[model samples]
Target: MALKILVTAKRVEDPESKIRVRPDGAGIVTEGVNYKLNPFDEIAVEEALRLKERHGGEVVVVSIGVDKSQTELRAALAMGADRAILVRHDGPLDPAVVSAMLQKIVEAEKPDLVLMGKQSIDDDQNQAGQYLAERLRWPQATFASKEASLESEAEQKKDPGVVLGADGRSLTVVREVDGGVETLVLALPAVVTTDLRLNKPRFASLPGIMKAKKKPLQELAAAALGVDLAPKVVVKRLSEPPARKGGVKVADVEELWKKLHEEAKAL
Candidate 1:
């Protein structure tokens, strides 16, 4: 059967170094924060597109964010997604709650494969994808840095027979593990979150961008999904990390080694 893949993308501010504390200390208003697709999510999208190209299937890119997220969705379309969906919302949400919202989408789409980033840059909670899988009761494989193979019982009657790579069609996954490398392959109808080491995401060319405008984008409101937007976890406060002091450059290896062993506490 052809692949039905649902890949998620997110919009976040570009990486920055400036940090200015707010008057209330509730959050830091970083300067010159430009929005872009989350890096890990871009990898996830690239993985989905590669699989679609190799396996012969459609790739659908999805996102949950405010109206500004459309730009990221368009980028996904330009990168080769057959279609895109934007689930728009206004406020910040806990990962668990976001998972509920995704569950509704997965139920409606009934995709064979779902992909997402390992974590969002803004919160770094990394709980949304796993929670979505749990809610749907589908198999889940997190932090996948490589391609995933799929098989079905329906394939057993075929000529060559289906040879799935270990994880079965239920929840097998091949992912990155510590100490050099290891892969975990899981079953079908599963979720696979990605890491930075995955394939580089593509940029939309001018022609691709123009074509993307003609592509269809289905918008679904969070309330329509029967989910309460209220968050269960409340953030009582937010604060910035302590500032790092400028370090003096050592003139020689001896001084560098001395600094590393003594003041740096490496020794």
Candidate 2:
């Protein structure tokens, strides 16, 4: 069955890059920081591509950020997305605002499925997918993964954890839960959030990268979408964790217990 899948690609600070809080505590120091596509979102894009490959269709990747976000969109295009859309906005964005913006896009695109990372690495808010689902009043399956397939490398690479119903009107999702995995059958036009074990993202080949330059990338202003960008949640400050103190060697378990109970008070 043919499908139109919409996936999100969020540009975030690369975890490997050195991150320092500004003196004023407004935000992180962006001077020399590096940026890349959010790893979870990369997995979402990979899943979308895999779904398209299994059941012939088109995959559309979208991002919301400054003009630089086009770089991430192009990266998704290079990974075999049919096209891209970018919502241009250079301001503070919270999960509420993002979900509102995505709602507008969903209304315009009307895809059969909306796929996104469970959360962005920079914020780690992990709320956008659920917020979007609620706003759209659609069924949702989050933390998608297949524990059984994950045990075998070959199986992990070959099979998709998310399975489409034979009739093509429902989805069978194997997702991670508190103690184990949980399965859910969601009707079509649902939202799904990807987890790390979903599928390994494919690297863009040289030819793919070259072709991506020529692919269609539509850019739209966030204001044009008519979704209010005012963030409901605001960050008051940013601070680094306190430095850890050097550990002291204890003579015995009794000493360790004494330190834990009296000094550390961790007991």
Best by lDDT: 2
Model 1, span 1-267: residue lDDT tens: 467889888888775545466778776674665788888888888777766765668889888889889999988888888899889887776888788988888888988888899998888888888998888887777777544322333222221111234333543345677764555555687888887655556677888888888889988887788987888777777776776888798899999999999998987
Model 1, residue 227: C-alpha shift (Å)? 1.4
lDDT of 2 by residue, 50-93 (tens): 88888888999999999999989999999999899999999887
TM-scores for all candidates?
0.84, 0.92
Q: Which regions in candidate 1 have their CA more than 4 angstroms from the true location? A: 16-21, 147-172, 260-265
Off by over 4 Å in 2: 151-157, 247-267
CA shift of 153, model 1, Å = 32
